[model samples]
Target chain A: DAGITQSPRHKVTETGTPVTLRCHQTENHRYMYWYRQDPGHGLRLIHYSYGVKDTDKGEVSDGYSVSRSKTEDFLLTLESATSSQTSVYFCAISGSGDGLGFGYTFGSGTRLTVV
Target chain B: AQSVAQPEDQVNVAEGNPLTVKCTYSVSGNPYLFWYVQYPNRGLQFLLKYITGDNLVKGSYGFEAEFNKSQTSFHLKKPSALVSDSALYFCAVREKDTGRRALTFGSGTRLQVQP
Candidate 1:
């Protein structure tokens, strides 16, 4: 939770290759998210970005795809990798510009294992 | 399209006693609640939020939350229990004005805490 950062904390791909998961932040916080934590589906939202190219789609956006040109980087791509997309993948950041509920700052996950 | 419900996927306390981890939400207009905590791989953190006045909102370690907008629920309490306070617990929602603030989680609740 220190400025957010998630990148291959652990990975073991194979399914169909093509996999990218990276989210970096320096607390610029303008909202950037990409969640995926299975096990009864506790965390969905497959994509989110509020600026720097602006993004959308959530609620498990298809096979997942995202990119936030700049603004602290936010990329999550799984073009192929399957096996139900493995699990544990979280990257969150919120608009903590002193407004809008302030509650989000996660990044310590990225346990993808799509054997 | 905002929804969150952690109808007990797991909850069992013992330690010092007192503990409740339940959450319910369904935003449509006014709602910006949250409570996150994940340990054992780590990712989610932010412990409290209720973006308006105070229906009981304290956070961090001695967690607290109770923003029941007429039973929409936002339960997450801890009076004593501490077995290191178990882990995994999340409940989120956002819909104040719904310009797509991105936040709608709830599919987690696993707090053992037994000693």
Candidate 2:
């Protein structure tokens, strides 16, 4: 096991409301990433953090923001949730920046529904 | 930009028969390939990866993938299909020395093993 945990395995909220998803890892991985899985799109990167307080946006990052305050915690927030933002959010951690002897470990994922 | 492609949206096979899920990728430089499996309502589980080695790579749950550099394909295969192997499979790729560490995932292919 990679010691990764994601909170709120399922959630439902009204449109325009804000929602936050948390990803915690027991392993001290240097890189943390947030991805959303949608039908026909596989998993698209939303945001990722290479280190504490350092982050970058991804292809589908328009409706989301992310923060990493500690080595173990990465937080993903949707400022105003929309029906289109309803997706299964996953967290993945890697030991290195590149794929040099490193592979990603994914979390259980948070299923968000915007009603 | 690097990208992965899964040509088939679904693959059906009978139990005890061999199975294959095709994946192709486009990236500059040598590619780092990976495969993941996802059951319903679950997070993605790492299957196997090929960085630089012999063509065949074996992973958990009796899964193996062959990396064909010339064809730019990494196809997942199993000697015998199991009903339990029915799940969504994803292929991902990251190019070496691309300055981007994130993986580009292909659209998933659903695998159904009928008894």
Top model by lDDT, which number?
Answer: 2
Candidate 1 C-alpha lDDT tens digits along B60-81: 8898988989999989898998
Error of 1 at B75 (Å): 10
State the weakest 10-residue window (summed lDDT) of model 1 chain B: B95-104
Worst 10 residues of 1 chain A by lDDT: A96-105
Candidate 2 residue-pair clash tally: 0
Tell me chain A's TM-score in each of the predictions: 0.34, 0.94
Model 1, runs deviating above 4 Å: A1-14, A17-35, A38-44, A47-56, A59-79, A82-85, A88-113, B1-14, B17-31, B35-54, B57-76, B82-87, B91-95, B99-114
- The per-model DockQ list reads 0.32, 0.65
Docking class of 2: medium
User: Which pairs clash in the backbone of model 2?
Assistant: none
DockQ of 1: 0.32
RMSD of each: 13.7, 1.8
| Local lDDT at A11 for model 2 | 98
